[model samples]
Target: MTIFTLSLFSNPLYSQVAVIVHATNQQALTESDIKNLFTGKLKSFPDGNPVIVLNLPEGDPNQSLFNQKVLGRSDAQVKAFWSKLMFTGKGTPPKEVTAEEMIKLVSENPSTIGIVDSAAVSDKVRVLIQH
Candidate 1:
């Protein structure tokens, strides 16, 4: 079980991360929009609908890759950034969730967005962008 779990996390096939929203959502979000949403900078869709952003736990493989490729920062840096924002009463980081929950919430809520491994994506959620 330990080896299986380790191999799952280390697999290159799952290295690609996908940002997803509700399947019926038609929002066209750019990379900057994604970065801002994840960073607590942008809170709404172009239509002015507020979003509920979800993230995988800190250090999760997909989360780490998303941070590097999309956010252009390390996981620790992201944690620190949120910490400072919270301390200064400026922002709140997205909620941390498992990959399964990400899919569940995003699929169920049109106003929600979240990340998951590219391979884990199902028809339940719509892919906004991948990184």
Candidate 2:
């Protein structure tokens, strides 16, 4: 795999790293799905129940990288994106936690998925898809 840098209109300091989620729960998540999930447009997996996506807390390095590179937004932009969606009753932003907490949450909650630096991956969770 290769890492590529992304320079968005707003944030441009994203690191090149694979953002991974739980493998078994989501076979393959399109870029749109990921964007929707982050933006709160889509809730739940292909299944009927609500899907809980975990994210590292604000200012976290991995979170910054994942948002800019994978989600294509800076923290402020992401907040604004969700503000619009949530106000419209279209979607809810993923729950945010610390990196370690997010990892543990994803590892225990079958329906929970999170993004993290590839180097931080462990056997605690199954890597579903990467981008």
Candidate 3:
């Protein structure tokens, strides 16, 4: 029999995740920028291109963390917020997607921004911000 050791620290999945956007998006985004984009406050990038915000499905761990830490809203709060906006005809909610789907969407659309675990980042996508 052989014994193997695996350190938690060595696991890449255990590493901290970085919030990313397309590098072509020259606008340096602050935490507020990210929040505003997702919440539909700021619709255009600094250069005036339409900005698209992608989000994970509700109840996802990363989505929950991102909502709490980045957007400063609980699941219910976000729901209510979107409801108000939609009913008012002011704005539409961001596109919701699975973690895997978001990765593909953000990468393919330069105007789109989405959050993903750092471990999932690939050469096909540009990681503009890591927060």
TM-score each candidate: 0.89, 0.72, 0.79
Using lDDT, rank the candidates from best to worst.
Answer: 1, 3, 2
- Each model's lDDT comes to 0.92, 0.69, 0.76
Question: Judged by lDDT against the true structure, how good is candidate 3?
Answer: 0.76
Clashing residue pairs found in predicted model 2: 22-128, 23-128, 44-51
lDDT tens digits by residue: candidate 2, 28-120: 677777677766667776666677877777788777777777778888988888788789887777788877677677777777778877767
Model 2 accuracy (lDDT, Cα): 0.69
93-124: candidate 3 lDDT, tens digit per residue:
88888778877787677888887877788765
Candidate 3 segments whose C-alpha is farther than 4 A from its true place: 1-17
Minimal lDDT window, size 10, model 3: 1-10
Clashing pairs in 3: none
What is candidate 3's CA lDDT for residue 113? 88
Residues 3-119 of candidate 1: C-alpha lDDT, one tens digit per residue: 999999878755789999999989999999999999989999989999999999988988999999999999899999999999999999999999888999998999999999998
Per-candidate count of clashing residue pairs (backbone under 3 Å): 0, 3, 0
